[model samples]
Target: MLFAPLSELYGRTRIYHIANVGFIAFLIGCALAPTLNALIIFRFLSGVFGSCPVTNGGGSISDMIIQQHRGAAMAGFSIGPLLGPIIGPVVGGIVAERLSWRWVFWVLVILSSLLSLVFLAFSRETYAPVLLQRKTDRLRRENINNNINNNAAALLRSKLDAGLTPRELFLRAILRPFKLLVFSPICAICNVFVGIAYGYLYIMFTSITPLFEQQYGFDGVRAGLAFLGLGVGSMLGVAYFSSASDRYIKKKAKEAGDLAADDDDGDGEEGMVRRRPSVGAIKPEYRLPPLRLGAVLLPVGLFIYGWTAQYKVHWIVPIIGTTIMGSLQLYLVDTFTIYAASALAANSVVRSLLGAVLPLAGGPMYEKLGLGWGNSLLAFIAVALIPVPWLFMRYGEFLRKRFAIENL
Candidate 1:
C-alpha cells in the first residue's frame, strides 16, 4: 500500500526497478538459507518486495495508455502473473525431483533477475507529475540566461504547479487508499466482493492437487498438469475481456453522451483519462458489466465442479467448470483493478488477506460437508454477492456524489 503511492511521486519505472532488485536479493537469500526459519523469513520478505508491481502496475498502465485501449493493455499485463502458477508447478516438480528443492529458488532468481534487468534498461517514466516536474526543471535551466520578457517567464512559471507541500502530499499518498475504503461505499463494497473471489481462487489453487490426487489417483506430475485446464480458461477469459471491456466502455460512454465525460484533463496526468468528447465520455460505472458476468459464473462454475467431481464423472467435466470459474474470475479481477487503480494497494491487501484466510477453511469445509456441500457454501456466498455489482452499476454515481469522492 505504501509503495503504490510512492510510484505516483517517484515514477513507476524507478519504483518497479527498485522493487525488482529487492525481490532478486531476497530470492537469493531464500536460496541460500541456513535453516527452515531463515528460509521462511526470507520468503516473507521477498513477497513484500514483490508486491510493488501488483499494487502499482495498474496505475502505470493508466499513466501510459488511454482509457479506450487500457483494457487490452491491462489484460496483456495480467497474463504473466495469472499464468505463472499454472506453468510453475509443472516445471517445479521436475526441478525438485531431478535437481533439488534449492534449485527452484535459484531458477526463480535467475529468471526474475533477467526480467528485472530488461525492464530497468527499457522502461520509461510513465507518471505524469514526474514527467511534468522534469519538464519544468529543464525549462527553468534552459531559460536561466535568456532575454525573455517578464510576461513570457510569468506564463511559463504559471504552467508549473505549486499544489501541495511535501509533507501534505506524502500524508495524502499514504492515507488515500484507506480513506477511499472507509469513505467510498463503492470501494468498500467492491473490495468485499472481489476480495472473496480472490480468496476463493487461492482456495481452488490448493484444492486442485488434492482433488486430482485422491479422486483420480494421479501422481505428482499429472496432478500438477490439472492446473492447465484452469490456465487455458484464464487465457481465454483474458482474451475476451481484453477487447470486450474496452468495447463496452466505449459503447456506454457514447450512449451516455456528456453525462459520462471523463474527469481527466488532456494533459499527461496519472490515473486520469484524456478528454475527447468526440470519442465518448468515460464513467466509473463502465467497469461493472464484466463484474456482473463474473457474479453469475462464480456460483454456476463452483456448483458444477463440486457436483461433477463428487459423482466421479469424467475429468473433463470438472475442467469445464474450472474454465468457467477461472475465466470469470479473471474478468472480474481485471475490471476491478482498472476501475480502482488509485486504491490498488488497499484492494490488493484485502485480496491477499482473504486469500490466506479462506484456504484455511476450505479443507475443513470439504472434510465436514463433503465436496458437494463444501462448494455449495461457497456458491451461496457468490450468489449473495451478485447484487453488489448491480447496485453499484445502477447508483454508483449517486453514491459518489453523496459521499463527495472528489477526482474519483
Candidate 2:
C-alpha cells in the first residue's frame, strides 16, 4: 500500500530502485539475524518493500505501451511471479538440504541485487504525469533561457500553474486506491473474485505437499515434483492467453469497423455515433473474456482434482486436473488484475492486498476439510460466483453509467 501510493506520486523508476535497495538490505538482515525474532521482523519488512514492483508494474505498462500491445507485456510480467512458487520449493529444498537456511536468504539477496541493478540501469521514467511534469519544467527553463517573453511563454506558465502541486498529487495518489475501494462497486467486486481465486491457488500450494505425502505415500522429491504439473499447465495457459489476446482485440476492432460501415451515412459524424458501440473505443470489459472462461474451468478443474484424488483414481488423472486448474488460474489472475486496473485508476493497491491476504487462508482451510471436501467447498463457492464475470461483461457499461464514478 505504501509503495503503491509512492510510485504513483513520484514515478516508477525511482520507487523501483529505492524499494529494491530496501528489499536487499532486509534480505541481508534476514540472513545475518542471530535471533528468530530479528529474522521474522526483517522478513516482514522485506515483504513491505518488495511489493513495489507488482504495485507499480501495471502503471508502467500503461505508460510504456499502447493498450493493444499490453497483452504480451502483461503475459511476460505475469509469468515470472506465477512461476515462483512452483520453482521456489524445488530450489529451496535443494538449498536447504545442502546449506543452512540462511543461505536461502543470502542466495536470494545476491540474485535480487543483480536483477535490481539491471532494472535500475535499464528502466526509464514512464509515468505520463511525471513525464509531462518534466517536459513542462524543461520548456519553462528553455523559454527563460531564450528570453521568449511572449504569449507562448505566458500560456506555458499558465498551464504549469494549473497543474497539480507535488503535495496534491501525493495525496491523490495515496488516497485513490482507498477511494476506489469505498466508491467503486466494480473494483470491490472484482477484487473479491480475484482474491478468492488467488487464495484457492495458495491453498493448493500448501495442501499439495501433505496430499501427496500422506495420501499418496510420495516422498519429498516426488511430492515436490507434483508442482511441476501446475508449472507446465500455467505456462501453457499463459501461452494461450498471450497468443490470442492481441488477435482477439484486433478481430473485435475489425468487426466493429464492419458494423460502423453498415451504419454509416453520407457524413463521418453520424457514422461515429453508430460506431460508439463498436471497437472504435475498446472497453475495459474486453479483458474479461478469459476471466469468463476461467470461471467455468476453475471450479470444474477443482472438482475433478479433488474428487479424483479423494477416490484414489489414477495418479495421472488428478495431475491432469491440476494442470487444467493451474492453467486457468494463471489466466484468471492475469485477466482479473489487468481488468481491475483498467476499470479503476491507481487500484493496484487492491491487487497488492489480495496477493498478500489470499495465501494466509489456505493452510487452515485445507487442515479442516482435508483435500477432497476442502477443495470441493472452494469449488462450490467458485461455481456459485461464476456468473460474476458474465454479469460484469454484459451489463458493465450500464453499471458504469449508473455508478457514475469520475475519472474511472
lDDT of 2 at 56: 68
lDDT for 106 (candidate 1): 99
Using all chains and alpha carbons, the TM-scores for the candidates as numbered come to 0.89, 0.87
Q: Model 2, range 83-184, lDDT digits (tens) per residue? A: 888877777767877897899899999999999989878888987655665666676677665555444545555743436666776676567666777887
Q: In model 1, which residue pairs have backbone atoms overlapping below 3 Å?
A: none
Query: Which residue pairs does candidate 2 place in steric collision?
Result: none
Q: Which prediction has the highest TM-score against the true structure?
A: 1
| lDDT at residue 362 of model 1 (Cα atoms) | 93
Q: lDDT tens digits, residues 203-273, model 1?
A: 88888889988998888778788888779878988988987899998787666654445665567554554
Q: What TM-score would you give candidate 2 relative to the actual structure?
A: 0.87
Q: Counting only residues 3 or more apart in sequence or on different chains, how many pairs clash (N, Cα, C under 3 Å) in candidate 2?
A: 0
